[model samples]
Every structure is written in C-alpha cells, then in structure tokens.
Target: MSSDLEPHGRIGVVRLGDALDWSTAPDVRTMVSTMWDDLAGGCLVLDLAATTFCDSTGLGTLVSICTDSGERGVRLIVAAPPPGVLRMLRITGLTAFFELYDSAEDALRSARAGR
Candidate 1:
C-alpha cells in the first residue's frame, strides 16, 4: 500500500493507495500522527478514491484517527471511499461518525467554508 500527503493551506489531504488492511493501517496511523502538529485545528481529508480494500483493522485505525482529530480540534473527513469501504462503514454504523464526501474537492470546499 501507498499513501501521499498533500497539504492545501490548512487542509491536509492524505491520498491512500489500493489497500488499507492490517499491514498498512499501522503505517497510516503513524503517518497521520506524525503530521498531527501541522493538522491540528484544521481539516483532514482521507482520500480513499484509489483504495480498493479495507479490513477491520483499517476501520479501527480510521476511528482512532477520527477520535484523535476531534480531541485536537481537527475536522476529519473521509472522501471518495469505494463501495466496499463504504459498505463496511455503513454496516459498522460509522457513517454518522465520519463526514463523508464524494470527492476530495467537496471535502475541501466544505472545510474551507467551515462546515
């Protein structure tokens, strides 16, 4: 799996790769944690448009990140999640816990408007 961090002013977009499973979840968590200082009080968009798979551990990592972001006053958004991931989130009842968007651009727009 691969991930890229793109910072657009106060909004940070993390573009995730093909898979977000057990082996990659920890790395993702660490990547976000490492960038926490820069992202604090801003917005974070997890760009999952390229991500094709996500396991339970990946979902747990997302929740952990969301909780941490909330505590740090950062807005967490999940953007462009594929059908599989979306289904898992819905089945797990996490759709309400996260701000979902159809694209990163939409997320950034909402964040910019302070929504």
Candidate 2:
C-alpha cells in the first residue's frame, strides 16, 4: 500500500495492498521495480502484512523482484505477508527464497544484523 526508502542505504519497504490480483499486478511490479534504480545496492524489504490476497502474477512479481535483487547483489526480503499470500509462498516453495518475518521492524533488524 505504501513504500518507504530509507536514505543513503539500499533498504526500501513496500507495503502490499489488500488486492494483489491481475488488475494491480502491473502497478505493483512497476512500483517495486522502480525501487531497484532508486536504491540500487541496498536491501529491499517488502512488507506484505496488508495484503489480503495474491494470485500467480502477484507471486511472480515477488519472485522477479527477488531475482532482480540477487542479480544486483541487493537482498530482497518479504515480511509479514498475509495468510493467503503466505500460503501461496509456501505452495510455491518461495518461503525459503525470502527471509520471512513477523513484522517490518523484525525484518529490518535482521537485515541490519546480517550486515
């Protein structure tokens, strides 16, 4: 729903909205992709706590972001995804691809600790 880019770091936060179907899929991708150039070498933390639903495309976008981040040597972490989205992540086995967290603060703390 909202995104916050911390200054002078590769850290960014994207708050996913409730509906992550086809309609908003492109926008979500664009929004998240834009962060790549903006915060090129930093970690990108996606906060999905507000997301109530996620379709294949939505999940695809997340995977793409993670891949893109890896290519750029920037870490992408998905945190607090809603139950449905979490289920999708588990189903897709992407739960292991991302650093799942219970909250945005925890994700950030983990990201910091890893550094």
Candidate 3:
C-alpha cells in the first residue's frame, strides 16, 4: 500500500495506492481524516489514477470519509478512478454519492465553483 498527500490551496489532493484493500484502508482513512481535520474547510480530491484495485472495505472507508465530510461541510471528490474501481462504485450504487472528476484540477475547479 502506497499513497501520498499533497495540499493544494483549498484542496487536499490524495494520490492513492495501486490497491486499496483491507490491508490499506485503515492507514488511508487515518491520513485522510487527519488532513480533513487540518483543512477546516474546502474539499478532498482523491486522485485514483494510479489506483488499480479497491475492495468493499476500501470503498466503505471512502464512504465513511464522504459522510464525515458532509458533517464537516466539506466536499469529497474522486479524480480519475480506475475502470475497475469506477465500475464497483456504479455496481454498488455509490457513484451518485460522490463527485467524480477527470482530474484533481477539474475537481478543485468544480468544488471552488460550487458546482
């Protein structure tokens, strides 16, 4: 499991691992939650371009983050999720629960634009 977080003005950009399964969910969640708490305001953009896999547990953690974001009045978005992960979201009917973008930049633009 490998990931990196980069802070953009008003946005926390997360470049996630190749696989986000049970083995990686906890750390990912912790890093993201901490970042969100630190940000106080703005949006979270998960750059899934390098992510090749995601399991139900990983998806659940993401949903948890999304839920927390709503309570914090922060937006949560996914940028460039791989085809498999995207399909899983669709299959699980979770696609509607998130803002899907082609890239982190697009996500930031839409979020800042209040779209």
Top candidate (lDDT): 1
Tens-place lDDT per residue, model 2, 1-115, is 7888888766888888898888888887888878888776678888888888888888888888888889977888888888888888888787889878889889998776765
Residues 10-109 of candidate 1: C-alpha lDDT, one tens digit per residue:
6777888888999989789887887778877788889999998999889998999999999998889999999999999999999999999999889878
For each candidate, the alpha-carbon lDDT, in order, equals 0.86, 0.83, 0.80
Better of 1 and 2 by lDDT: 1
Tens digit of per-residue lDDT, candidate 3, span 9-32 = 566777887888899888888788
The lDDT-based order of candidates, best leading, equals 1, 2, 3
Give candidate 2's error at residue 56 in angstroms. 1.1
Count of clashes in candidate 3: 0
Off by over 4 Å in 1: 1-8
**CA-RMSD of model 2:** 1.4
How do the predictions measure up, each by TM-score?
0.91, 0.90, 0.86
- Candidate 3 residue 103 C-alpha distance from true site, Å: 1.8
Which 10-residue window of candidate 2 scores lowest in summed lDDT? 33-42
Of candidate 3, the 10-residue stretch with the lowest lDDT total is 1-10
